[model samples]
Target: MQIVDRLMTPSPDDADARRCPHDGTTLVSRISPLRSAVRRCPACLRSWSDVTTSATADPPARFHSFRLDVRPEPAAPSAAPPAPELSVVLPALNEAAALPLLISDIETALAGESYELVLVDDGSDDATWAVIRAVLAERPQWQAVRLSRRFGHQAALLAGLAAARGRAIISMDADGQHPTEQLPEMVRRWREGARVVQAVRASDARGGMLKALTSRGFYRAFSRLCEAPMRSGAADFRLLDRTVVETVLQASRTTPFLRGLIPWLGYETHHLTYEPRSRIAGRTKYSLRRMARLATDGMVSFSVAPLRLATLVGAAVGALALADLIYIVAVALWDGRAVPGWASTVGLVALLGAVQLFSIGLLGEYVGRTYLALLNRPPYVVAERIGDSSGPPPAGERRA
Candidate 1:
């Protein structure tokens, strides 16, 4: 029997420096080998010989053959079908008036391909659900899910995406601010192998100066904090490939900022600029308080900037306290002045009050989140599901 030694190459591309099984020494070739194939290590000299033809021969002579074929067969092609046409998910709260126009625009956007429109009603006190049902009745292409109570805008959007059947999904505002005309461009980007296609609203002709300025500032601050490739003027109106959608969905947390989450999930993304149109109907759902809360969520979810800021503040306070102690010591030793009782009392009170407030605020932020989690409160609840209840209920509907 012939003995053969095998060596493992460092890389598929590298042919030299193969490990020798006999002496455990690396074998280096003067010239590059034809292919980096697994061969017998020279050190151990361990080998296997063919004895089929020499079965009757006793103590057959050993022959070394290094020309044996070790190539592997090529893999078979994938049998999976092409991705679905498009899935449009709209999150609406008290947007009954704008639903018709939004639906119409979506239908126009998906003219060439088979598409499904999912409307998530975020527990609107108005006739939003009624309007959604009416639209579905008139347009069979549309489907909807109603939350038991208001689950906030982001949660509703998540619900819609979870229920989407299309291989590519588009998320837009129910306020009709997002331009449906941009759909063709977004779809083109998707076809060109972009996993995430963002609709960046470069101009908001309908918004006032104050709103525009605030938005620009927020985006700027957010971009700086996030590591993802975030650009200014990007909005939630965007399209995602099936893989990206699945990836984002898998990262399901109670506080979901999809716009930020898209970048966190590494994928090829494309951005298209468009002018945000005016709302077709209904007042804006996002009040100042809600916007602040959303901003806080986005900041905390994507970055530790706040925590760092808190650290800086604590350090600054410590330094100030040290300075105050030094000042009091100087007055006692050198100034030969009596320590003013009111001044010390006032300074201590203010300093302690500021510290207490800051600490409470920081603790409240973390405590509030923990409370929500402990309660096991769902992000949203589905009161009724239209079209295919056999399938999974809308996002945030499943009880943990």
Candidate 2:
């Protein structure tokens, strides 16, 4: 057999060779885990091949080859990180300007706590997705979902909630109007066993007088009409324990009015009242038309009062018509007088026609909502995603 010997570049007697580079332990020649040809550091477990004996029959020739050091044992794969304790779900709509500061504020607010931020881009025309990507690169713990199109605020919030994977999830707007500073207090309440923690805004200065009046009015009307009790100032800014989050997702297939749904769920709830802050940048996505639609949805979803009121109106109109007809007929029969007021007859016909049309329209609203629910379409489609290492599976992805 051919005898091949190898030498290390530096003599082991030298300072560099004498001490282990990793832990300062003395280097020693020992039987390698592989075979007898390698030397290793006992402390660091790094091995270097000092000699190799070939199996070839070459008259016992001595061959000198360069020292071969086996690569350090492949590091044991790191275990996956634990799940986050809390998740902040922000449904963004063209709030690119506010994202940078909003993300910073959230990180600062949630410092020393294990939390994830879930950003849902509701098909923003602005650089909202781009900004989200940059933030994700810097903060790998956060995740984002981009919708195929603008699916409204409720749909976006649903998508974020579906994507969030923390023990407790907080849903809020991306405009920075919802204060991140209150997050800890929300969490504190959650820790105290509150399944639903609502952030109640006393007034929205940015929304102006008309919005405030309408908002207040809607809640007052909603409370009296619907069995589900909702506080006037309660909004989308709220915290849900994992149980509540899952319950909401399973319960709502269509776009849900969360302000109404949360109370309807009847979980142990706590409320925190705070003043609304101005947007960090950009205008509010909620327009007058959108607010009206939201109110309509809330009223329609939770209450059949409109339909009942329609029925009551029809009955009252019928009773009045019957009484009038009896008066006219009795007078005609008793006095043998012909009723000849064409204008009065025409006005009565018009009044009846208006009532009939109003009842039909109210009935149509309920029918329309039922038809939509029957269609069973996903509320929002996720076109793309980033940072899925921890968040839930893509909620209705349409991969490009």
Candidate 3:
């Protein structure tokens, strides 16, 4: 791996020194978990690697060969330490092809840093669990959580965050929408006293004309109708302070629209606008139907405006009826006959009927959601968790 800092070059004289070129501190070298020539210092958070290219590289970037010491190490003493400085919570679903590579990118970005990686497998039908196991086998710094079933993205993310053991927790996508390179900026902002660092999308780079128009309308309507003001292009890729994380877990609603819910926390939020990259693997887990459901969740979870909308429609219909009555009275006094037309009457009845049905449906949606929430169901159920050799899984967990 190419390092920007003045890393020590391999030479007979320098090799004997075995010290960090930037600092006079002694450098400890060992075969990395990935069996790479990745020389790093835990104290300094500085690293560089010597790698041999293979078919894994597309069209061969370079070619060489090297060796790694793969001898089994001795057992460790039984002791536990403090939590990591940062924790990244990745909610994965059918992202086996992209998880390992994303893990690599995250490692590279946080090279030598004291951080934990929490990968949550949100009930993928594919070999995602196998990939998670393989990644855990490669490194003890990573933790993987698997749910019993698909509990949707927000729930999966909450599960990961609840399991996270970091001072500063980050939530991102496993399919590569949230870039790993900007992690430093997020940390910097967090250290600057912002409890939340929101990675706002620069643009909705996908969707057709109709989709775009509908999305715009949805946000506009949501902002005006709902008590919570959702930022346009706000994304779920974000960092939450440990206090906020704990607070969220304590609040523990059965359903949470995290994108809107995070903002509702009223924390000191810092905005970091970035253009999202396309996934390096399969299609998005969120289909159009799922998107609509998410939108509905956001709308209903934050406000009772849908119910108010029914009231508004009822009032507007009453106003129209009053206007019609006045017109009929005036027409009878002027010509001894009301304005002739069954057509107008049929049209008005149809319009009123449709509006009333739609209003009832909207009201029913809120009631139905409230009913489900009242049931007090668990947001998610954990199937298993791997990695974190330091200790057993948290309370009420199943081992795999």
Write one digit per residue (lDDT tens) for candidate 1, span 68-106: 324354577875543357889999988988988888887
| Model 3 spans with C-alpha error above 4 angstroms | 1-77, 321-341, 389-396
Candidate 1 Cα deviation (angstroms), residue 162:
0.7
Better of 1 and 2 by lDDT: 2
Q: Give the TM-score of candidate 2.
A: 0.74
Per-residue lDDT tens digits of candidate 3, residues 1-400? 3233223233333333255566554333432222346755533666655432344543221112222323344577876666899999999999989988898889898887789989898899999999888878877767888899999999999988888989999899998878888898999999999999988777775756666676777877877877556677776789999999998998867858887777777888999988788898998777789889889888888888778777888888878876776776677778766556753586578768877898878978878888998899889988898866346755677765
Candidate 2 per-residue lDDT, tens place, 1-400, comes to 3232334333444443454578553333442222335655444667744533335532112222245334455578998778799999999989899989998998899999989999999999999999888888888867898999999888899989888889999998898888888999999999999999999997756678888888889998998899777888889999999999889899889988888988888999999998878889888777889889899998988889989988889888877777777777777778857556653486578768878999998888899999999999987788888875543556566432
lDDT over C-alpha atoms for residue 397 of model 3 = 74
The predictions' CA RMSDs to the true structure, in order, are 17.5, 10.1, 21.5
TM-score of decoy 1: 0.71
Give each model's whole-structure lDDT: 0.73, 0.80, 0.77
| Clash pairs for candidate 2 | none
